[model samples]
Target: MCSGIEHGSCRVSDDGRLVWAHVVLGPEEDWQECRVVLDARDGRELARLPLDGAASGSHHMSHPDGLHMGLCVGMGQDGILLHWARRDGEELTGRDLDESSDRILMDVHPGHPGFLTVEHHGADLTLHALDGTVLAEGVPEPSDEEDPPRWDHSCGFVDADTVIASTVESDEDPDRPLHWMLDARTLRVRDAVVYPTGRVRGHVRPLGDGTWLTYDDGSGTLDRWTVATASA
Candidate 1:
């Protein structure tokens, strides 16, 4: 049992071997902070690290390897927090990829040690190696042709070769928000897609087969989407 579970960040690794969470250290309003790595089966606390100067930790994604996990302060920050599951007490690193700031962790590649990040909205989408080298970045055309579109905050890998993302239109038809399939390496838009629903700020998660999931706030339900369906 953990306290402050609602305000914390939590995730279980793909292999089901570990669990990581960020919780407040003290009272509610004065909530001091730290992240905890736990033994998944027994709910034992394996380690905890303090997050100084952060309002609260929110976004968390696990690496496919099960030992590497990424954490973000969930604000418009300049870095991502990486933690090693095997390391002892308070073990973590605050990393900023060479020149990229205000970028947040979106997802980690399943076959590689690298991760993905995008500027606050969908402005600058970049992939960086574990050593901070840029693997690839996006070059989408300007949205000025129509009303400017706002880059979305959620995106992730649908497979080793592709990524899925959303775009919020400011002047374009608001009825159809733009979703995209991008090449994992070159970050090129392979396809543009839309949903039967309206604009929402949530995640596009790959379900390990050919399907993806999105949250439809209007219905308060998880909506399923697929690339094959869109193409047909």
Candidate 2:
């Protein structure tokens, strides 16, 4: 069910039949290997894939047509990796991200021709097409002088063109919050908001219609925000 590895990623199949988890093994002294575990209906291990080298990040994404699944992998300093499989656990393929960048992967958008958003040094955000083409890139402005923010984690897409990204001060101040509404196509800041409290460490996803949900580790709270129908 759970590998209990810190800083790993997990995802359930779109059909709700299988659960896939990629856990990092070995200590920092050794080159960590990513262990991909597939669970059956009863939460039993069906198959295991030991992927050599470090896994920068991993998550589940619905393939085109929503009929299959994709296991996205981020090999730090190497490149992006993708493992695709059918719902029945048959027919699988693995591929690299196509783009080359030292920037940290923020999240992958699961839609037609899936794309990825990565945060480069200096809080610059870069958007890449599924084929590894550079779509757009931009540097985000810090929230305030006292609380200069850094783009740390993000949710892929809130809609066809918008992504909700969580920014935080480098000094690790919980009372200062920096959130941004970025254009997925342009990688530009469309709007921004400050939470006034709490620290966010993950992507913000849409709850249903217009509301988004994100985690605040400082106060152990899940903060929800309603998307403004119109930009200010």
State the lDDT of candidate 2 residue by residue for 124-213, as single tens digits: 767665545677876666555664556665545665666666564633554544567777678788776544343345557653244677
Candidate 1 Cα outliers beyond 4 Å, as residue runs: 1-6, 26-32, 75-100, 145-148, 170-177, 194-203, 214-223
Give the deviation of candidate 1 from the true structure as CA RMSD: 4.8
User: lDDT, candidate 2, residue 84?
Assistant: 50
Lowest lDDT sum, 10 consecutive residues, model 1, at 75-84
Q: For model 1, how does the per-residue alpha-carbon lDDT over 36-146 read when each residue is reduced to its tens digit? A: 778899998877767654533466777676656676664324343433333444565444343336677778766655677777655767887765577888845455455
Candidate 2: RMSD over Cα atoms? 6.2
lDDT of residue 124 for candidate 2: 70
In model 1, the number of clashes is: 1
